[model samples]
Target: MSEPVLELTGLTKTYKPGTPGAVQVLRGADLSIAPGQVVALVAPSGAGKSTLLHIAGLLDLADQGRVTICGQDMTGKSDRIRTAVRRRDVGFVYQFHHLLPEFSAAENILLPQLANGVGRSAAQARAMKLLDRVGIANRADHRPAALSGGEQQRVAFCRALANAPRLLLADEPTGNLDPDTSDQVFAAMMELVAGTGLSALIATHNLELAARMDRVLRLENGRLTEITGQQAGAGFLQSD
Candidate 1:
């Protein structure tokens, strides 16, 4: 079999380690995600789900562990190298839209590509195509302030895909949208990822949405466990 797109071994993170207020968030958390896979991460608030995502995405460093993305060992890599890898191979979406108010939807989507030195024409073309794929081509020229929450989120989705990342990380992506809009956005994102065969690890509280993913795992007591097939079908708790 091919190597996993993402791999974490003995990952651990502690805040204020060696200080009086040190708190351990992850205790040897381990996980592996194959290319083109869609995995849902379910955990209660303050359960360290976001912490794990940040570490796995290389946005934050683990106190003790290893992270390999696309077969590249990230351990001991410099901040610059990690940042480059993240910009090139990882995409992130947060609960909030986080789009710049001054930029148009298309421009916002093209920002990352431009930052990576993609030509203006090529980046714009790719951004426009992503916006079209997400069903928001008509709103390309609109700013975040001019769009609805769902539309803004759609724009953010397009921006995340602009880099053609190998791995996508989403934290509570649909937490702020209404049920119907949330479902629609989630479906659209999944469809796009499926089409591109990109791997994704999403942290979400929406059990119904999580149930539809290829696999589901729960973060509890600082460890990751596969959700039972029955529980997956029944859906996880919105609160837990």
Candidate 2:
């Protein structure tokens, strides 16, 4: 079998450790994502789902744990090495679409590929392809400020995948939109993920959207618990 695309073991994180107002967020959290599998991470607010994603994506270090990506151990690695791995193998999306207001949709996507050493023409082609996948090809030349909320988020998704990362880590990719828009944007994101065959771990509060993924896992007490599709709708309730 192919190796997992991402792995986390014994992950633990705390805020203001040893202080009077200290908060322990993660408690030996463990997770693994296989290649081409889309996993939904369901959790309540402040359950440390973002923290876990930060650690897995190499954006933040865990107080104690190991992160393995594409078979390489990231624990104790140098910052330079971690950054290289992150830029080359991982993509991230958050609740808000943080696109550059001045750049066009295609430019936003092309920027990352250009940074990764892709040729200009090649990057532009890939950008168009991604935008097309998300049904936003015609909006490629529009800036973020000129697009609707759904369109902006679709651009962000394309940017995330521009580098062809092996793993995608998203936190509430469609949280800011209304239900109808969220569903539409999410379908586009899933289509992109499926077409690329990359592993994704998406954290979301919407269980209906979560259930559409391959598997659902709830984050409770700073740990992850695999849950059934039937149990997905009740994830937030059970996490409380």
Candidate 3:
């Protein structure tokens, strides 16, 4: 069998350790995502969804536990190695589009590939293709200010795919849009990821969206538990 795209065992994170206000964000949190799987992470505010994504994406270090990505163990690795691996293997999307307002959409999408030493022409071609895939190719030359919220987010999605990452992490990716626009953006994102056979872990508050994923897991008490589709709907009631 193919190896899982990501695995976390006994992962834990604590803030202000040994101080009065120290709080534990993750306590023995564990998760795994296989290639081509789309998993939804549901949680209430302050349940550490972002914290967990940060650690999984290699942006933050966990205080304890093990993380393995694409069959490679990450524990005890140097910061430089971790950064390199993250750059080459993981893609991230956040609640905000986070595109640079000054640069054109295509330029923003090409930046990461250029940083990774890909040739300029090659990166531009890839960025344009991704923009086209996300249905925003016409907006490639427009800056963020010239685009609508949904268009900017479509650009962001194209940017995230620039590196062709094996794993994708999204934090409330559709949070700011209206329901109809959110559904469109979500469908486009999922269709693109599915076509590439990439695994994704999405953090979201939308129960309807979460239920449609391959699996749904809820974050509570700093740990993750699989939820049935019926249970997912029930959980959202308490979340609100």
Candidate 4:
């Protein structure tokens, strides 16, 4: 079998540790996402889901744990090495679009590739392809402010995928849109993922959205529990 795209073992994190306001967010949380699999992470706000993703994406480090990406262990790696690995192997999206207001959608996607050393002409072609994949080829020249909410998010999705990373980490990628727009944007995202066959771990509160993924994971009290079969529908309701 192919090695897992992302792995977290014994991940533990504490905010304000050893202080009067210490809070432990993760308690030895463990997860393994195989290549081409899409996993949904469901949790309430302040439930440490963002922390988990940050750690997984190498944006932050855990107090005690190991993060392995594409078969490489990231324990105690230098910031430079971590950044390189993250740029080469991981893509991240958040609730907000966070696109540059001044840059066009295609430019936003192309910039990352340029930073990663791709030539301008090739990056431009790749950008248009990604925008087309997300059903926004015509909006490629429009800035974020000119696009609709769903269009902006779709551009953000393309930007996140510009480098063709092996793993995608998203925290509520569609949380800001209306139900209809969210569904549409999410479908585009899934199609993009399916086309690339990259592993994705998306955190979302929308149970309906979570149920569509290959697996559902509930994160509570800093630990993760897999929910499958009928439980996928009924289990998330308990959080409400």
Which number leads on lDDT? 4
Identify the leading candidate in terms of TM-score: 4
Indicate the residue-level lDDT of 170 in model 4: 94
lDDT tens digits, residues 121-168, model 1? 999999999988889999999999999999999888888889899999
Better of 1 and 2 by TM-score: 2
Winner of 1 and 4 under lDDT: 4
Clashes of each: 0, 0, 0, 0
Identify the runs in model 2 with alpha carbons over 4 angstroms from their true place: 233-240
Candidate 1 residue pairs in backbone clash: none
Candidate 1: lDDT of 41?
94
Q: What is the C-alpha RMSD of each candidate to the true structure, in Å?
A: 1.4, 1.3, 1.3, 0.9
Q: What local lDDT score does residue 94 receive in model 3, on the 0 to 100 scale? A: 89
Residue-wise C-alpha lDDT for candidate 2, range 1-240, written one tens digit per residue: 999999999999999999999898899998989999999998778899899899999999999989999999998999999999999999999999999999999999999999999999999999999999999999999999899999999999999999999999999999999999999999999999999999999999887888889988888888889998656555443433
Misplaced by over 4 Å in model 3 are 233-240
Number of clashing residue pairs, candidate 3: 0
Overall local distance difference test of candidate 1: 0.91
**TM-score of each candidate?**
0.96, 0.97, 0.96, 0.98
The CA lDDT at 205 in model 2 is 83
At residue 64, candidate 4 shows an lDDT of 99
Q: What's the distance in Å from true for residue 2, model 4?
A: 1.2
Best first by lDDT, ranked: 4, 2, 1, 3
